[model samples]
Target: MKVTLERNHLLKSLSHVHRVVERRNTYPILANVLFKASDDHVELRATDLDIEVTESVPAMVSTPGATTVPAHTLYEIVRKLSDGAEVRLETDGGENMVLTSGRSRFNLACLNPDSFPDLKSGAFAHEFDIAAASLRELIERTQFAISNEETRYYLNGIYFHAVQNSASGSLFRAVATDGHRMARAEIAAPAGAEGMGGIIVPKKTVGEVQKLLDGVDGDVHVEVSDTKIRVTVGPVVLLSKLIEGTFPDYDRVTPKNNDKQMLVDKAGFAIAVDRVSTIASDRGGKAVKLSASNGLLELSVTNPDHGTASEEVAVDFETDGFEIGFNARYLLDIITQIRTESAVFLFNDANSPTLVKEEGSEANALYVLMPMRV
Candidate 1:
């Protein structure tokens, strides 16, 4: 097989697909990427048994054939090559594949393409198109809250499903939680995605899909089945297996009647939380106290070994005095997700979960944070 492609094209395609290849594989072929050249294009495919990524790039194919080569090795070589250089790859039915660029040449061991495992995708039960920007926002707003705990496998990923919103009618919602905090984001559901069931997308898959959607405009095609989910963005296709465990009922955790409202500058509140957390004790647990009452908000943290710190910020609070303790890191996480200038916090009491929302926006996103003992 022989093909010639521009250095930039090959490098970009490799970067998109090679991330799926594992560094250490029980099967030798699993560590390599399958390259096939035919019909004026080259296809690159990589998989780690559970997830697969395939990308196609325009190339000049002099000979039509296929082979497998080390994914990282090839990527590094192409990355170091001079810009605008033409890269030539050829293998004449031999164990070694020849790579040639301007003033450079290298031979890499090749594996039989037949040895690569097939990533079978069954019939898609639902297919819809969503704006790339909206999809990316959904992932970014909720992915940070996904749990890293392995014991409760259900909390390790984002849960996606269709729901009815009173203000916006049909909506596609994404929710993630790790017991300490929970994040939820919604976008208008596409026309064809009415009765789709909920699916738990693994954290790794959500990250990869986020990368593909970065800086991308227009619509992305999404296909989902019972066991797998597939996303198509332009010339790239990403497939991932769904988490087998069921996600917990997140609605029950959200506070229904938190009427104590405290509105503060989002940026200022985030800065105050960060500043007080500096004096918090990592060994004793990083905790910060939030005391809010009519137009005043005070943040305080104390560590017996270290020192104590507090900061007062102005807010638009009219409710009676209320104080709450929470993990500093958790408060910062939810604050960062607020895109507006003001962050609105609703509290029932010191121990109840607090509800956060972006002030003055039609965007349907909410965050629930569980308070901790001081």
Candidate 2:
């Protein structure tokens, strides 16, 4: 393969697919990216058995062929080269790949394209269009709450499902939970994505999709079967295997009616929780106490080994006094996502789940944080 691509153009496109390259590989080909040149486009692909990412960028193709080049090596070379320096890449006799820019030259070991594992692209049972921005928003708002514990493999991914909102018809939603905290975000279902089943997309796949969605515009062709799922966003396609386990009954866990409510500034709330956590014990969890009543909101943390910290912030509240304890990190995870003037919190009592919502985007996004026993 012989192609000349602009440095920035090549980097941006390669960045989308390179994440699939295994950091530690048993096979050399698995560590390389499959580079194919045809017509006026250069395609790059990498996989780690479970996930595959492919991307294409416009380039000047002189000879149409394909080869596998060390992914990280090529990326490092291009990244170190001077900006805007056009990069020329070619393979000689399928033995090695050569990269040249100005006076710099680097020869990288290459493997024939036939040695690369199979990567498939096909018709999706449900092909739909979603604004790159919209999908990114949905993923970002809920991904943090996904469970990282491997023992409970089922909670390791966000659950994508079709949900009906009493206020606004049917919506496509992404929900995640770590048993203690939960996050949910919804968007209007696109025209073609109807009657789709809930699928659990592993965390790695979510990160890959988020990386590629930057500044991208267009519809992603999304298809899901019982075993595998594929998303083609523009010139990039990400294929991943679905988690086989079933997600928990999330609906039952959602609090029904928590009459006590408090609306506080999001930034102030996060900052207060952060400061109070500093004095709390570093082990177990960073627990903080929240006291809400009248128009006052107080945050306090006491460390048996260290000292105590507390802060008071003005908030809109009208209910019986409530003191609740929660992990500071979990609070920050859900609070940082609130992009509103005031973050709304509803509670039942000390040992109940607290519902958090943003004033303008309350229904669009919601969080359930189970309080810690103090």
Candidate 3:
């Protein structure tokens, strides 16, 4: 197999696909990327059993063939090569693959392409195209709440589904929770997605999809099935297995009658919480107390081993004063998702979950954070 590719083009394709190759693999072939060259194009594919990524780049093909090579090693070599250098990869039915660029040459061990695992492409039950920006927004707003606990594998990913409401006929919703906090975001459902069922998109897949959407502007093709999901962005394709467990009914956890409203600057509130959290006791708990009255909100944290810290911020509060305690880290995570300058917080009492939203936005995104005893 022989192919000549530009340094930048090869580097970009390698960077996109090689991330799926595990650094340490139980099987040697799993650590390598399968390279297939034919008809003026080179396809790079990598997988770790559950997730697979493939990227195709235009290349000058000399002898059309296929082989596998260590993904990380090849990526590193191409990354360090001179900019604009023409990269040539050649393997003559030998155990070693020769990589040549300018005066630099490296011989890398090659693995049998026949031994590489095939990524199964089954017929998808649902397929649609969504704006990359909208899809990216849904992921960023909810992914932080996905649980990392292995025991509750159901909570390890974002629950994506379609819902119907009086306000919005059809909506695409993404919900995630780690038991302490929950985030839900909704967008207008794309055509052809109304019949789709709920699926748990694993955290790794969400991360890889987010990476593919960065600085990318176009419609992304999405395909979903009972056990797998596939996303296509231009020349790259990402396929991942859906988590098997069922996600809990998240609507039951959201507060319904929280009427007390407090609106504050998102940046200012986040900064105040962060500053006061410094004095929170790591031994006892990292909780910060929020005391809100008419037009002011005070944040304070106390630690037996350390001194107490307090900060006051101006806010728009109408209801009577109330105090609530929450994990400082959770509050920061929720606040970061608010894109607008103003963040709206709804409270029932100090003991119940608080509802948070961005003010003056038609986007139906909400965050629920359970209170902690400070």
Question: Residue pairs in steric clash, candidate 3?
Answer: none
Predicted model with the maximum lDDT: 3
Off by over 4 Å in 3: none
Clashing pairs in 2: none
Writing each residue's lDDT as its tens digit, candidate 3 over 310-366 gives 999999898656899999999999999998899999999999999999898584799
| Candidate 1 root-mean-square deviation in Å | 1.2
What are the runs in model 2 whose C-alpha is more than 4 Å off? 121-123, 360-362
Worst 10 residues of 3 by lDDT: 276-285
* lDDT for each residue of candidate 1 in 95-210, tens digit (9 for 90 to 100): 88999999899999999998888789999999999999999999999999999999998898999999986777888999999999999998889877777889999998999999
Say which prediction, candidate 1 or candidate 2, comes out ahead on lDDT: 1
Q: Please give the TM-score that candidate 2 achieves against the real structure.
A: 0.94
